[model samples]
Target: MVSVRDDATMREALTAGQSGALADAYDLYAAAVYGIAVRITNDHGAAEDVTQEVFVELWQRPERYDPGQAPLRGWLCMIARRRAIDWRRRQVTRDRYTLLLAGQALPAPNVEEDVEASTMAKLVRAAVHDLPPLYREAIALAYFYGLTYREVAVQLGIPEGTAKYRLRTGLRRIGDSMSSVRAE
Candidate 1:
């Protein structure tokens, strides 16, 4: 909802390729973008990198943003969120690969037990990740965020019973998935 007059200077900077304009935009919007990154990444260093990446992209591809389409801060926050999510995914994959290598390099004393434990952990993670979005959101709020059912309902703007139901259903699905692994 930025009026043309409000964004005239920014539009000019983006079009004319003015350095100071980019700097001014960075100073104004960097903190908001960084806050979103930190919320998602939960790592200040990664958030900092994400924030820097956002501004660099803005500077490099100013034409990608349309002031008429959305506010600059909102567009930047959306980009920050996607980047932070991508970073977290890459980190998870890297960590898993590193662990695999380390496991091969140093075998545990009880190979059977270690393998079983690792397999169960993977199964549990997969079960949670594969949950439908509705149940997954409730599970994340109630369990990961440590919100009580009532608090989760309030956070998600749903009734308490609905929140509890989602949590129960999600956990039941996970348990069903894990039951086979337990038997094995």
Candidate 2:
């Protein structure tokens, strides 16, 4: 067993895949990584996920960590920060898509709330709910669950081409409804 105080030895053991090195690293660094993730993501669940990803990356690609460029702790923290930011961004996108399709008002990022935009949001939500079950299921699978087209197809027992078509046609119908509203 390498001395835990010697980070260099621990890293060398880690690169060599020696047993206990990873555990030592987790003992020394997991708390710091988890702390950074929680601060950036503002969610404990997301923070735990991010922490796991960071450790996995470290274990899978220890060579990526250049001890000369930065310390092991610094590299781990950097990875955690980036992962937490990505997690937060995905959540924001999911929330935005969910709001638009779940009968909620759209949130303007930097501009004042426009009444016209709000009305269009309602129109889109109504159009989505009015869609036939086939298209509605496709939308829910893709947007609500964040599944890829292939995954959606697999989940719904449909061909990938059919899933793509349903997503496109469903969106097109919503567009058509909005277009008609604007025309009137």
Candidate 3:
């Protein structure tokens, strides 16, 4: 297994396309990458894809590594996080207006208030319940499920943009509703 600290050497090996070095790196960091991806994406398959993409990207852009700054793992994980976020954001954009254009009404919400928490939790749950279906899905997947936008998109089979949009709109709506509930 390769030591993650010797990023300078790793960068050199990667730039030279040394398969052994890459394999060593994979052996050293695959678990770390997968753990982070799984935490961010909350889906095994999507996390696996993100993990694969990170390595592929590292190989394609080996020169991007800078030993003067963070370690190789840091750079790799950053790329994974960004890619995952981008994936979900694209999904959000694609699905944003689809149902509206179809002239279909928003589905009835099935959110249940959490009785265990305080009134704020209950109100928050109520607000989430009132959100549109897509928004609710996005919010739940992103927050409750601990998934990045990319993983959410993969799980939902939607564009990343659409997933992002849902999260944004859902949060805004929930905030507004919760404020109103609190004010009353």
Candidate 4:
């Protein structure tokens, strides 16, 4: 067992790439790092992840630590705290995205409502079909085909004012038909 008496010795041993020094460093500072992580994150699982990440970072980049700047315990605690806070931020962002996606998702279909709406649409289509040929053509061109009034006029070879008048008259006739059906 390598005896890590002080931070300087630990640094020297770590710089020399001794695995025993890493074990010794972990033994000395793991509890303090974990404590800081738990305090910051307030979650046991997240704290454990943060603790593991701190040690992995230390093992991967031993040269990053300078004993002249700070003690090993303080450095490890700082890393743990930062990792914990970052984990919390990531969790918050993930939860927000989940909620946003849920809000935007399509709702399940209602059988009765779907049936009623489909029946009403069929009735309206029948009424439109019963309209006079001139009005039926204009309404189908402007509404069903999503054409503007000017486009409908151009397509049907009629004046724009004539197209508008046909559309209005056609809609009124459909409304009257639907009203009569409802009354019966």
Q: For every candidate structure, what is the RMSD over all alpha carbons to the true structure, in angstroms? A: 9.6, 16.4, 15.0, 27.8
lDDT of 2: 0.81
TM-score of 2: 0.57
Q: What is the lDDT of candidate 1?
A: 0.79
lDDT of 4 by residue, 64-114 (tens): 998776557667777887898898889877877787788965445589998
TM-score of each: 0.54, 0.57, 0.52, 0.53
Q: What tens digits encode model 1's per-residue C-alpha lDDT throughout 97-172?
A: 8988878543346888989889878998899999999998888765554456876676677999999899999999
Instruction: Tell how far residue 124 is off in model 3, in angstroms.
Output: 22
Residue 6, model 4: lDDT of 65
What local lDDT does model 4 show for residue 168?
96
lDDT of each: 0.79, 0.81, 0.75, 0.81
* Two-way TM-score contest, 1 vs 2, winner: 2
Q: Order candidates by lDDT, high to low.
A: 4, 2, 1, 3
Best by TM-score: 2
What value does the lDDT take at residue 73 in candidate 2? 67
